[model samples]
Target: FHAIMNLFLLPLWFLSGAMFPISGAAPVLQALVWVNPVSYAVSGLRHGLHGFAETPAVLAGPAVCLVVTGGFALLTLAVAVWQVRRPFFQT
Candidate 1:
């Protein structure tokens, strides 16, 4: 499970622009970064901490994060409940 989670998160770290500026990446990668939830969070943090200029997207980041986080929480909770309810004999 840990390995699987890392596999998923590792791509996100790069796609989220955490490893470098999004502008420095390829156009295709830049588009992906624009849609990545982590990008908004990072952009928001950067703006907040370093006085980076807030683009319209960056200005919306906090609200987007709240909604995205809530959705993920609900999805995780539903999955956990479903797993717990599964029959033990089911392989």
Candidate 2:
């Protein structure tokens, strides 16, 4: 689980534009960033802290981030419950 989380989070950090602006990334990478939910959260943080000198077209604003965050939370909760209820090994 730790290894899987590391594998997932490493790309998430990079592709979410935490290390650099998404605009400066390669076209393929930019496409990936747009699809990543973390990118919207980063955009919201940047906007709240620095203001959007040039907002990315993909980000609708903080409201979108809130909605996405809530959705992810609910999804995670549901998955956790499902996992807990399921048998570790089927007969």
Candidate 3:
């Protein structure tokens, strides 16, 4: 399970611009970064820490990033609550 999750999520972390900026990335990668929730979170943090003056070129500005990150958080919270409300199998 851990390995499978890593296989799925490692790319997400990599594409979140935690290691490098996405500006010079390939178009496909840039597209992926734009859609990634983690990317918005990273962008929000970057904006908070450095503002736009020193940060790399982000696809969305700080306001947009804030909205996207908050929306993503709410969405994930809703999904988690929904999942918890569903019936579960027991051994």
Candidate 4:
């Protein structure tokens, strides 16, 4: 389970711009960072901590990041609720 999750989570973390700013990354990587919810979360946190004016370069403005993060949260919440409502076993 640990290895399986790492396979998914590790890439997500790396592609999330956690190690470096997305601005200096390649176009493909920048696209990946833009789609990564974790990236938005991290950007939102950074903006909050450093204030919008002083944060490191990010894919989107603080408002955009906040909206995307909130949307991702709502989407995941909806998926979780949907899954919970489904039968656990099809037997």
Superposing all C-alpha atoms, what RMSD in Å does each candidate have to the true structure?
3.5, 2.6, 2.6, 2.0
Candidate 2 per-residue C-alpha lDDT over 55-88 given as tens digits, one digit per residue, 9 for 90 to 100? 5543557788778767866887999899999999
Candidate 3 vs candidate 4, lDDT winner: 4
**On residues 1-91, what C-alpha lDDT tens digit does candidate 4 reach at each position?**
7998699789988998879888899999988888899898888778887774766666578899889999988998999899899999999
Off by over 4 Å in 3: 1-8
Tens digit of lDDT per residue, candidate 1, span 6-67? 99778877788668777777999989887776676666566566554544334245567567
Between the candidate structures 3 and 4, which one is better when assessed by TM-score? Answer: 4
**lDDT minimum window of 10 residues, candidate 4:** 51-60
lDDT of every model, 2 decimals: 0.70, 0.78, 0.84, 0.84
Q: What is the lDDT of residue 59 in candidate 2?
A: 57
- Which candidate, 1 or 3, has the higher TM-score? 3
Error of 4 at 47 (Å): 0.4
Q: Rank the candidates by lDDT, best first.
A: 4, 3, 2, 1
Worst 10 residues of 2 by lDDT: 51-60
Model 2 regions lying over 4 Å from their true place: 51-58
TM-score of 3: 0.80
Question: In model 4, what are the clashing residue pairs, if there are any?
Answer: none
**Model 1, stretches more than 4 Å misplaced?**
51-61, 69-73, 88-91
Measure candidate 4: CA RMSD: 2.0
Ranking by TM-score: 4, 3, 2, 1
